[model samples]
Target chain A: MSCRIGMDVGGTNVVTGLFDSEGRLLRRSKVRTIKLSSCELIQQLAGQCKEILAAEGVRESELEAVGIGLPGFIQSESGVVSSANLPFNDVPVATRLQQLLGVPVAVENDVKMVVYGEYLHGAGKGYSHVLGLTIGTGMASAWVSDGRLHEGAGGLAGEIGHISFPDISYMCGCGMKGCLETVASTAGIARQARDGLKAGWVGLLAERFPPEIRDELTSHDVWQAYLDGDAFAGQVFQRTANWLSRVLVPSIALLSPDVIIVGGGVAAAGDIFFDSLRSYVSASLHPLYRERLRIVPPSLGDDGGLYGSAEFALKSRKIGLRI
Target chain B: MSCRIGMDVGGTNVVTGLFDSEGRLLRRSKVRTIKLSSCELIQQLAGQCKEILAAEGVRESELEAVGIGLPGFIQSESGVVSSANLPFNDVPVATRLQQLLGVPVAVENDVKMVVYGEYLHGAGKGYSHVLGLTIGTGMASAWVSDGRLHEGAGGLAGEIGHISFPDISYMCGCGMKGCLETVASTAGIARQARDGLKAGWVGLLAERFPPEIRDELTSHDVWQAYLDGDAFAGQVFQRTANWLSRVLVPSIALLSPDVIIVGGGVAAAGDIFFDSLRSYVSASLHPLYRERLRIVPPSLGDDGGLYGSAEFALKSRKIGLRI
Candidate 1:
C-alpha cells in the first residue's frame, strides 16, 4: 500500500503523521525542535519521517511522497523557506528532504496547509473560494481557490497580519507600525491586557493575576476572565474582533469568498470571539455579500496541517506524473 | 473571417468593438444609453451588436460570440445582470443576446473585463497574477489569475469601493460611511476640494470657480489648478493618493499579484498622483514583496474592456464546446 508522511514543523516541536493513500492518518510522532544549522535541521526532519514509517511497519520503498508545513515565507515553486520561527533562510527544503528520503516532496506555509486541510475535509469543503485566517501568536491568512492555493506571484500572498491598521501605534515585529497582528493576534491580546494592568486599570486581571504575575499573562487567562464576567477582559476581545473586522471587511469586499475560516488559538476562545466577529463583519459588509458569506470556526483541530500536507503530497505526485 | 463582438455597456453610453479571431480590434461603434426597461435595453444591445457587425461587413454567421461588460452585479454562470447603473435587474443578458445573434455570449463585471484586457494585451501581459484597480467616478478592483478572473463564489468580488475608511464621515452612494471611494475616487477628490472651498478655505478654486459654479467643480479642474501651483488643489490630490495607498497596501499584502494595473479616468492625473501613491505603497510593503511587484499604469487606455470582453467570449466558446 502506498503511504505518505506529513510533517508540521513549528518553533517548539515537529509533528509527523503517517497517512494512507486515502488520506487517513495511521500513526503520529513528535520530536522537539532544537536550534540547529539548516543542514542539521533537515537531517532531523528526515530522521523523524523515517522513524514514523519504520514504526508503522511500512518499508521505505512503499512511501509515495512526503509533505511539510513550515512557518514563514514559503516559495513552493522554488521549494525554499525563509521564516524567523525556524532556522530557515531561503532554504531549499523540498530538494533537501527529497534527497534524504529518495521520494517526492512538497512544502508549503503551515497556515496555508491548515487552510488546505480544512478546504478538503472541514468547514471549507465544497467551497470554491476560501479565505483562511489563523490568529495564533501572530495573525496571517491564506487563500484557496478551486483546490489550488493562490500563492501570488512571489508567494507572499495572505500577509494580512502585516497590513497597517489606522490610528494604531503598536510596533509589529515586522518593523512596521500598527500592523493588524500587533493588536489582533494571541500575543496581541495578551499584550493589551498587560498594558491595561501596567496602566493601573482596575479589573479582574489585577485582582486575580496581580502585579507581579501581570507580565506572565496569556490570552487564555484574559479569555477565562471574560468568561467569568470581567468587563475589562471583555473589551480586549471586543477590540480584537473589531480590528479583525477591519481586515475581513476589505477581504470580503475584495475576494467575496464563500467561507472565511477563523482558525488557530484565538479561535479556541469560542463563541465569545466568533459571535462578535461574525456580527461586526456582517454588519459592516453589504447585504449582497453578508447574505452569502459564512464565517465559521475550524473543525479539524491541530492535525489540519498534517492532513493537508499528506494530501498535497499525493496531489503533487499526480501532477508530477502528468508533467 | 471568424470574429467576436465586445460591448462595454455603461450608464451614459454603450461602446462596441469587433475583433478578429486573433483578438485584434477591427471596428468600433457607439450609441447613447437611454432609460429603458430591461427587455427594451436587451433589444437595444442586440441592435447595437448587429449594427457593429454590419458596419464591419461581417455576416452574423461569421461571429463566434458576443461578450458584454456591465456595471453592477453579474452572475455570469446564470447569464443574469443585476446592476444599478443600467435597467438590467437580474436580466438574462447572455441568453437574450445569444438568442438574438445566434452566437455564444458571456457577461462579466466591467472592472473584471478591464483587468482581463490588461492581462491579455496591456501592462499586465507576461504576468501570472494581475490585480487591476479602476479609479473613475468610484474606486473598484478586479483580479485575474493565470488568465481566469477570480469572480469569487457570489460574483461580487471586486467591490473595494464600498469598504469603509477610518475617520472619514462622508456618506457613500452604497449607503456606507467613510468608504474608500468617498475620498480616493475622481468624484471623491472633487468632493473634498468642494468641501474645502465651501468651508471658506482660501484657494484658487474659490477665486476661479466661485461659489455659484462651485457645485459643478470637477476633478479635471482640480488637477489643472494643482499643476498651476494651487496649494489647496495640491493637498486634495496628495490626500487622495494617501487614501489610495490605504487600499493598495492591504491589497498588496493579501494578493501579492505580480502587477497592479492602475486604470480609469483618475490615472490621467499623471505623475502628480501615481508618484506619491507608488512611493507610499513601496515604503509600506516589505522588501520581499516590494522587489517583485510592479505597480503600473494601464496601457490599453479606453478600449481595455472592449478587448477583454471579446477575448473572454472566445475563451468561453472553447469552454462551452468542451463541456
Candidate 2:
C-alpha cells in the first residue's frame, strides 16, 4: 500500500505521521526539538523519519513524498524563508528533505496545511469555502477559498496575527505592537492577566487557580474562569473575543469565507471563545454576512498540521506513491 | 477573439466594460442604478449588461462570460445573497445576468473583484502578495493570497473596514462601532474634521476647502493644509493614518502581504498619510513579519475595480488567463 509521511516542524517538537491515500493515519510519532542549529535540526528530522519507518517495519523505499507544514512564512519556491517561534532561517526544507530522504517533498505554511486537512476531513468537511485557524502561543489562519489553500503572494498568505489593532498595549513576538496575537492568543491572555495583577486587580485566580493560571494564563484558564463566573477572568476572555472580532470583521467583510475552522490551544476554550466570538461578529457584521457566518471549531485539533502534511504529500505525489 | 464583459454594480450607477483576454478595455458604458425593487435591480443590472454588449457589437454568443462585481458578501453558489450598499436582496445576479446575456457570468464582492483585478494587472502586477483597497463613500479591500481570492468560509473574508477600534467616533455602515471604515475612510476624515470643528478646534479649512473639505475636511484637504505647514491639519491626517495603521497592524501582521495597495479618495492625500502611517507600522509590526512589510500606493487607479472584476470572471471560467 502506498503511503506518505508528514512532518510538522514546531517550537518544541517535530511531529511526523504516515497517512494512507484516504488520509488515515497509518502510524505517527514525535521527537524532542532541542535548540539545535538549523542544519542539525534538519539532520535529526531526517534521521527520525528513517527511524520511525524502520520501527514500523516499513521499508525506506516504501515511502512516498513528504509534506512539511511550517508555522511561519514560506517564500515562493523557497520552502521556509523565516519562522518566528521556531529557530528557522532561510532553510530550504523541501529540497533538504528531498535530498536526505531521497523522496519528493512539499513544504507549506502549517496553518494552510491545517486548513486543507480540515477541509478534506475535519471541521471543514462538506464545505467548499473553509477557513482554518490555529490560535495558541500565536494566532495564524489559513484561507481555503473555493476548496483550495489561499497562499498569498510568495506563500505568505493567512498570516492573520499581524493584522493591526487599536493600541500598543501589547507587543507581538512578530516584532510589531498591538497585533491580534499580542492580545487574543494564549500569550495575550497571560499578558493581560499579568498586567492586571501588576495593576493590583485581584481575582479568584490567586486562590482557585494554580501557578499556570497565575503566572501565565492560557486561553483555557481564562475560559474556565468565565465558565466559573469570575468577572475579571470572564471580562478578559470577553475583551479578547471583542479584539478577535475586531480583527475578524475586516477580514470577514473582505473575504467572506464559507466556514471558520478555529484551532489552537486557545480555541480549546470551546464555546466560551467561539460562542462569544460568533455572537459578537454576528451582531456586528455587515448585514451582507451577519447570519451567514459560521464560527466552527477545528476537529483536527493539535494533530491538524500532521494530518495536513500527510494529505498534501499524498495529493502532490499522486496515488500516494511511496519512496 | 475571446472577450468578457465586466460590470461594477454601485449604488448610484451600474458601469459595464468589454475586455479582451489581455484585460484590455475595448469599450465602456454605464447606466443609472434602478430604483425598482430588489428583483428589479437584478433585471436592471442584466439590462445594463445587454446594452453594453450590444453597443460594443459583441454578440452575446461571442462572449465567454460576464463578471459582475458588487459591494457585499457573495454566498458560494447562491449568487448575491446580500449587500449593504446595493438594493439587491438575495438576488440571483449571476443566473439572471447569465440568462439575460445567454452566457456564463460570475458575481463577486465588488471590493474583492477590484483587488483581484489589481493583483492580476495594475498595482499588484509582478508581485505575489498585493492588497487592493478602495476608499470612497465607504472603504473595502480584496485580499489576494498567492494569486487566489481569499473568501473566508461562509464567503465573508475581506472585511477590512469592519475591524473594530476603541473610542469609536464614527458610525460604520456595517452597524459596528470603531470599525476601520468609520475612521480611515474619506468619509471618516470628513466626519472627524467636521466633528472636531464642531468641538471647537480651529483651522484654515474654514476659508479654503469646499463643503466636503472645508465643512468636513478630507484627508485630501488635510494634506494640502499640512503642505502649507498647518500643524492642526497635519494632526488630523496623522491621527487618521494612526487609526489606519492601528487597524492595519494586526490585519497585515496576520497575513503580511508584501504590498498594501492603498487607493481611494482618502489615499489620494499622498505622503501626508502614507509617510506617517508607514513609519508607524514599521515601528510596530510583530518581529515575525516586520522585515517583510511594505505600504505602497495602488497601481490601478479608478479603473482598477473594473479590471479586477474581469479577473474574477477569468479565474472563475478557468481559462488560461493573464492580468
Candidate 3:
C-alpha cells in the first residue's frame, strides 16, 4: 500500500490526511496553524506531522511522500513561495518538508489541487474540460482541458479573481481596480450588505443585531440572515450571482467545459447563489450555447484541496509507505 | 520529400499550399469555393487540388498527406461537418475530401490551425502557454497549453467571441444576448460608427466626408479615416480602443499566458489599437501581474492560419490518420 500524506494549509487550521492509491483516506488529523515566525511555523508543521503519524499508529518509514496544498501562487517545480498568503517569502517548502519528514514532498496552490480532485473524482469527473472555481474572501479558478490540468506559463493560468471586470470600481488586493473578486466573491457580498445596513437603508437587516456583529459581518452571516428573510441579503446575493454569472457564462461559452464545479465557503449559500447565477448565465449566453453549459456544485466540498494533494503526492512518489 | 498539402477553406476562396518538412511553403494555388451543394463543393475542391498538383509539376505519390482547415468546429476524429459558414450540412468532410483528392486528409477547425502555427513556427514558439486572438468581423481566441492546442471535452474550447458578456442592449449573430462580440468586434465598431454618422452627431466625420460616404461606413474605412486624423475618426478609434482594451486586460490577467498574439483585420489598427490597449491593460491588471503579461503581433501574419493548419494536420496524423 503506497500511502501518502496530504495537508490543506489554512490560516487558522491545518488538516492532514493519509490517503491510499484509490483515493480513500486512511487516517486524518487536524491542528492549528500556530502563529509564529518563519522558522517556527515550519517546526510546528513538523510536529503536527509527527502527531498525525503517532495518532495513526504508523511508522515513519511507512510514509511514501507528503503533499501540502496552500493558497496563492505556487512555484510547482521548485516549490518556492510565490503567493502572498504564507508568511515565508521565497521559502523552499518542498525541500524543507522533504528534509523534515525524510520523504519526497509536493506542494501546489490549494485550489489548483482541488481542481485536480474535482476533475478526477468529483463533479467534474468524466469531463475533459472543467473550470473549478473557489468563491470566498477571494476568487480563483483552475482549468482542466482534455482530462489534463493546464498549468499555464509561469504557473499563473487560473488567476481569474484578480483580473479587472466590467462596471466594478473598487481596487483589489492585487492592486487592480474592479477585479472579479471585488464583485463576485463572498467578501464582496458581505461588504455590500454591511454598507447597506450601516447606512440605515431600508432592507431586511435584523435590528437586534449585536454591535460587535455589526462591525464584522461575513458572507456566512449574511447568508444566514438571508435565509431568515433579509431582503438586503437576498439583493446582495442576487447582485453577486448576476456579476459572477457575467464572467462565468462567458467563460463557459469560451471553454465549453463539460462541467463547472463551484466550491468555497460562499457556495454553501447553495440555491441563493446558484439559482440566480444559472438563470443569469443562461439569459446571457449566446443562443447557440445557452442549452449546453452545465454548472454544478463541487462534490468533494471542503476537503477537495486535501484529496487533490494526496492524489498529486501519490502520482509523484516512487516509494511505499503509510501515514 | 514526403511533402504535405494544407488547405484553408474560406467562404469565398479555397487556398491550397504545399509544405515541406522544413516549414517552407513549396507551392501555392487557389480557386473559388464553389457555392453549391456539399457534393459539388467537394468535386470542385478535388478539381482544384488536381490543378494545383499538375501546375506545380508534383507527382501524386510525392504527396504524403492532405490537411484542411475550416472556420467552424471540427470533430477531427469523425470529420464532422460543423461549419456554419459553409453550405455543407453535417457532411463527412475529411473522408470525402480524402476520397476525392486521392490522399490522406485531416480536417481541423481554422483557429486550431492558427494556434498550431503559433506553437510550431510563429510568435508562440518555445512557450508552453499561448493565446491567439482575432478581432475581425467576430472575435475568436485559441489557447495553446503545454505545446498542445487545448480542445475542451466537446471540442469546443477557445470560442471567446461567443462568451456572454455585458452587452445587454444588442443582439449577436449567435442569437445569444449580451455576447462579447456585440461590443468588441469590428462589426460592432462599424455599427457604432455608422449609427453615429447617421444620427448627424457633430464631429470630424462630417468635415472629412463628401456627403456620399458619410453614413455608410465600414470599420476599415474608419481606420483609414482615423489615419487621416479626421476628428470623428479620432473619437471612433479611441472608443474602439477602449472597448478592445477592456476585453483584453481582464482576459490576460485571468489566463496569464506566456504571450497573447492579436490578429485579424481590426488588429491591423497597429499603434492605434496597441498603444491604448497596452495602457488600458496595464491599468486594469493587478500589480503583481502588471509586468508579467506580454502582448505582441502575430508573426505569421495572414499566413499564420495556413501554417497552423499544416501543423494541426501533421499533429492530428500522429494521433490517428482519421481517414
Candidate 4:
C-alpha cells in the first residue's frame, strides 16, 4: 500500500511521478521549468506533487516519501548549493518539501539520481560498480559502488565536465579553459562545427546554413549531416568519439566498473554514435580491462532520473529508520 | 600478541615487516626481487616472512594473518591474475602464502595497499576519501572511498597508467601509444632527456654524461640537471608536471577525494616537482572543487605498502569472521 512521489527538476522541464513500492508508475505530471525564485519553484513542485498524489488516490499521510533530483552543486544535508542553470542557490529543498507534504524528503543531484535509478532498475542493474555519464549542455558523471553512490569528500564527485584538456582552446562555462565539456558535450559539438565552418572547412553544414546563419547550427543538424554521409560531419563526430575515449579510457582504467551507462540529450543520438565510441574505447583500453567493460545506452531514458529519485527516497527512509 | 606479517612485492624488491595490532613495526627484512617463476617468488616471499616473524620473536600460533601487496592485477580471493611488471600470471598468491604460513592471507594490488595504508595511518588519515598516485618506472593509482578500496568489477581498478594521450606519440610498456605513463613516469622523463639530447638539445646532462654515455641518463640525472639550471631538463620536468596535472585534473573533478597523495620513485624528486604540480592542478581545477581539494606527498615513504598490507590482512580477517 506504500507509495512514493519522485520529481526531476531540470533546466527546461520539471517531471514528477508517483510510484508504488514495486516501482510501478501510478501517475505522472510535467511542467515547463521557468526561471523562478527558490520559493516559487518549491511551491510549484509541491503543487505538482499534490496533484499526482490526488490523481493516484493517495493521501499525504499514506505517502512513504518524496524525492527530488535537481541539476547543480548540492550538499545532501543543506540542499542545493548552487546551480549554473537553475536559480536555486543555497536553498533547503528537502526540508521545505518535507514541511509542505508532511513526509520524508530527499534531494540529490540529477545525474546521481539517474545513476542510482539505473543501478537499481535500468542498464546498471546487477552491477557491483556502476558509472553513469551524461553528455548534454555539459558533461557530467556519477559513480555507484556496491549499490551506494560514491559521493566524494566534498559531495562534488562525478564533476567530469571540468576535466581540463590543454590542447583545446575553448573556454567552458565553469570558467576554465579547455574543459572536457568544452569539446565533448552537445554544446561543444555545435561549437566545433561552427568553428570548423568559420575556418573555411567545407561541409554539408556550410551549404545548408549560410555563413550568417551558421552560428545557429545545432548538434541535431550535425547528426543529420553525418547520417547523410558528409565527410566534415563525420570528422566532427569521430573527433567527439576520440575525445570521449581519451577521458573514458582513464575512467575505465581507474574505476573498472562493471558497466558504464551513458545518458542525457546527446546520448539519444543512439547506435550511430555509441557503435564508434564502444570500438574506440575498447581498442584504447588496456588489454586486461577490455574483456569485461561494457558501455551501453540508458534503458530508462528521461524517467531514469525520476526512478532514481524514488529509489533514493526509499533507501533514505530505510537508513533513517536504522538511525 | 596478535601479530601480523605484511609483505610488499615490487618489481625490483620485496620488503616484509612484522607489526602488532597497534600497527607498530616490530621487525623488517628486505630482499632483491628478480625475474623469477611464480613458485620461486612465492618461496622467496615465504622465506622472508619467516625471517621477519622469527626476528620479532613471534610464533606461528601468535600470528593473526599474512597480507601481501604486489604489482599486478589481483583478484583478492584468488591472488595475482596477471602482472605486467612481475612474473605472476594466474598465480594463487594468497593460498600459497596461507599454506606456507598456516594463517589467513589477503593479497591486494600494491598501489591499493599504499592507498589504504595512507588512508588509515598516513597522510590520508582523517579523510573520508583518498586517492594515491605512484609515478615510478611506470604510473599507477589507487582509490580509497569511505574507508574501503574502490576496486572496480574485475579488481583492475586504479590502472591510471594506461590512459591514452593522443597528442604524444610515445609508446607505453602496456602496448598502448601515448599513455599518461609514456610521458609522466620516471622512465618517460629519462626517455625525454635522451630524446632531447639526441636532437642536439643542450643541457647539463650532455656535459655530465658525454654523447656516448648519454643513453645511460636516468630520471635522477634529469632532476640533478634541473637543479643545476639546465633549460632542457627544466622543460622535461615541466612537461612531466603538465601531463600529471592533465590526468589529475580529470581525476580530481571526477572523484573529488579529500586528498591526493603522490608517492613512488618519481615523487622523490621532492618539493621542486610537487610545488609546481600543486599550483598547476589548483589553477586548472574548478573553483568550487579547488577550495577543499588537497594534493600532498605520501608520509609513509617506502613503508606505506607494508603498512597497507598489514591493514589489509587485519580487515580481511574481520570480514571473514562476519561472513
lDDT against the true structure, per candidate, is 0.86, 0.72, 0.74, 0.83
Candidate 1's residue-wise lDDT over A221-319, tens digit each? 999999988989988888888888877887888888999999988878888788889888877667788889788999888888998888887887788
Ranking of predictions according to TM-score: 1, 4, 3, 2
Q: Cα lDDT of model 4 overall?
A: 0.83
After TM-score superposition, the amount by which residue B80's alpha carbon in candidate 1 deviates from its true location, in angstroms, is 1.2
Top-scoring candidate (lDDT):
1
The C-alpha stretches of model 4 lying farther than 4 A from their native spots are A201-203, A321-323, B33-37, B84-87, B321-323
Local accuracy of candidate 1 as per-residue lDDT tens digits, B219-306:
9999989888899998887788888887788778888899999877777788877887887787677767778867889998889999
Give the CA lDDT, 0 to 100, for residue A6 in model 4: 85
Strongest candidate by TM-score: 1
Runs off by more than 4 Å, candidate 3: A210-213, A317-323, B164-168, B207-215
True contacts kept of 1: 0.69
The candidates, ranked best first by lDDT, are 1, 4, 3, 2
Interface residue Cα RMSD of candidate 1 after superposition:
1.6
lDDT of 4 by residue, B1-323 (tens): 88898888888899998999788988888899887888888888888888887888788788888888888878765664578778877877888878887888888888889888989889999998899999887788899888788777877788887877667898877788888888888989998888888888865788987778977889999999988889888788777877888668778877888999998877888776787788788877778787996888899888898899997898888888211
- Candidates 1 and 3: which is better by DockQ? 1
**If you assessed candidate 3 against the hidden native complex, which CAPRI class would it receive?**
medium
For model 3, the DockQ equals 0.60
- Candidates in order, TM-scores: namely 0.95, 0.81, 0.93, 0.95
For residues B288-308, write the lDDT of model 2, one tens digit per residue.
456676777777665666887
Could you arrange the candidates by DockQ from highest to lowest? 4, 1, 3, 2
